[model samples]
Target: MGVSSGGPGTGLLDRRVERGAVDRVLDRARAGNSAVLVVHGEPGIGKTVVLDYAVRRASASDLRVVRASGVESELELAYAALHQLCVPFIGPRLEQLPRPQRAALAVAFGLREGPAPDRFLVGLAVLSLLAAAAEDQPLACVVDDAQWLDRASVQCLVFAARRLLAEPIALIFAVRGPGGDPRGVRQLRALPDP
Candidate 1:
């Protein structure tokens, strides 16, 4: 099914079938477990509707939610998605990260001058930052149209997703799929029309 552009509520038609998976993800996050869920389907298959449901549920449960969307035009810009995901959470909490990790993120975000960052280092920095934030409250990071994300952002985010254990954070990606799959992440493919 496709989402309607009229407004909220109007677009989430026929999405009951996807509710269970979203509930499970939210349940895991509430239990202090780290989780990553990828919801993939063909374009206009209501993936955004599912993501919106997750966001609403997470917010209702008091989880801190951070959202970002990848623009096709920004696909060439390194760390663009990561910047969007982490900018609101950046603050004194980032100072708690290991020195090198801190520097890596700063370099990537243009917050300071430094050598080009290692992708893994940046990813670890992201993981640490999310974990640190989670200590204050459970966190949910939502990325829409992840298929359009930059290569570097995808690498870093996937790295962070793989390492999310024992932390109260949930990383969710809504990607245009049915053909493309984000490597090494747990996937929940949406059903195609009959």
Candidate 2:
């Protein structure tokens, strides 16, 4: 089935349908360990819905929530995911990216840049910035439409995923099959078994 069935508010969201798995993830996060749930299927299969439910429940439990979406046409746009994860932390020092890069990141986030710029760094910088911003709270980063995720974005996540246990972050990615990238799935499946 496509991810539409897996999109937000689908049948799998009954809580009774997959509460155990969700609870386990919550438990792990509560214990200060990160959790990754990669749900892959065709478009409209409800993957987003499953993650949405998990995020909502996690939020109710006081865990911080950050949501980011990948657009089908601009996978290479830098810092799209990172900006969404940073919106809750905006301030004077936050807008430090160069004008060009800031504009690119703004488009990536589907927004227009304000007078000040937030230099959206690429690769490892994204992780370091995010970790620094979230130093105070337990955080979860949810990126939907992973199939459209850029190579750099995937690599950034891979770098972050490897160090999740030491950091208070969970990276959850949802992808649509046929349309989903096989290499992405393989990399996700092989995340050091934790």
Candidate 3:
């Protein structure tokens, strides 16, 4: 699950996937610019499948991959995206946050607070730091169901994407449009073309 899809291209469905967009993204990623890929379409339009294929292809090329999903139930927490980035490493040394903030986040997500901003920041910071630390490898942050992202998490991700432009990191947000957030679409369009 950490490496290549070990198939012909991105994967089975990739044969039918939009190669131009995917190739453009890969080409730019190889050039050291992080991409904010938004796969927007009607519901059940296979956005996730396309992104999965892209990610698998990227992993085959030795890119480091991190995956997360936004949930409708927890849309107000400041770091839902961050938590998705950190879940694989949840454990000790992560429980040190201010109770109010922790409880608010925990209750929203139905998870116990580890600590105040410490745990939350750990995932967010670590992802960025990993990009900074790896000079030869590309970092891929695959965020699924992005339309469900809370305001805070969405803003944080936008900020993170801007910072990753200075590093070897690429972001792929699988979004469902029409009913999705217009602001998110506009924000992504505003990113400097790299």
Candidate 4:
């Protein structure tokens, strides 16, 4: 994170590596490819600044950006953060999903009464929903404060991220805090940097 001159995070200084990685992901999305990036750092390190930069750039390129931030108070609530990220597509988009996926999402979001849906179905539904949303335009999902996200939401997002293929979508996450999931963070850290 660098000092902000304040416009779409363009003012950020000394962040070429971070910015380049973000640009590559956006470029891939523009080319109808799927990409995922996880921004992890201690608090106050400009993770948000980089996210803002990605949002601005993606928007400029006509990508539909959906954003969500984990709430500490809602950590106990299953699917809370995932719900925020999916809210934009829940209406018409939900109809595009397969019957099983639609039903799973409906139950997960508490829109219907049913037994707990299968976990794999929920993750697949999210992936299907996002892929469908990108049919008209590339999609960008920005999730900040991921360390505080509910376990279920994190698992679903991670599953979706790992399964993305040929969809014009970008999934980015910003995770902070020492109390976060060490295993998840370590796996993300293992991902190639740039």
lDDT of 2 by residue, 65-141 (tens): 88877786767666555566557754432365544544544554557745423333333345554565556777777
lDDT of each: 0.85, 0.59, 0.59, 0.83
Give lDDT: candidate 1, residue 151.
92
Q: Given candidate 2, what's the lDDT at residue 128?
A: 55
What are the candidates' C-alpha RMSDs? 3.2, 7.5, 7.8, 4.2
RMSD of 4: 4.2
Local accuracy of candidate 4 as per-residue lDDT tens digits, 9-116:
366655666777788888888899988878777677777877888898899999999999999999999999999999999998888789999999999999998998
Give TM per candidate: 0.90, 0.65, 0.64, 0.87
RMSD of 2: 7.5
TM-score order, best first, reads: 1, 4, 2, 3
- Quality of model 4 by C-alpha lDDT: 0.83
lDDT of 2: 0.59
Which 10 successive residues of model 3 have the least lDDT summed?
185-194
Q: In model 3, which regions exceed 4 Å deviation?
A: 1-17, 87-127, 179-194
lDDT of 1: 0.85
The backbone clash count of each candidate, in order, is 0, 25, 7, 0
Candidate 1 lDDT trough over 10 residues, lowest sum? 1-10
RMSD in Å for candidate 1, one decimal? 3.2
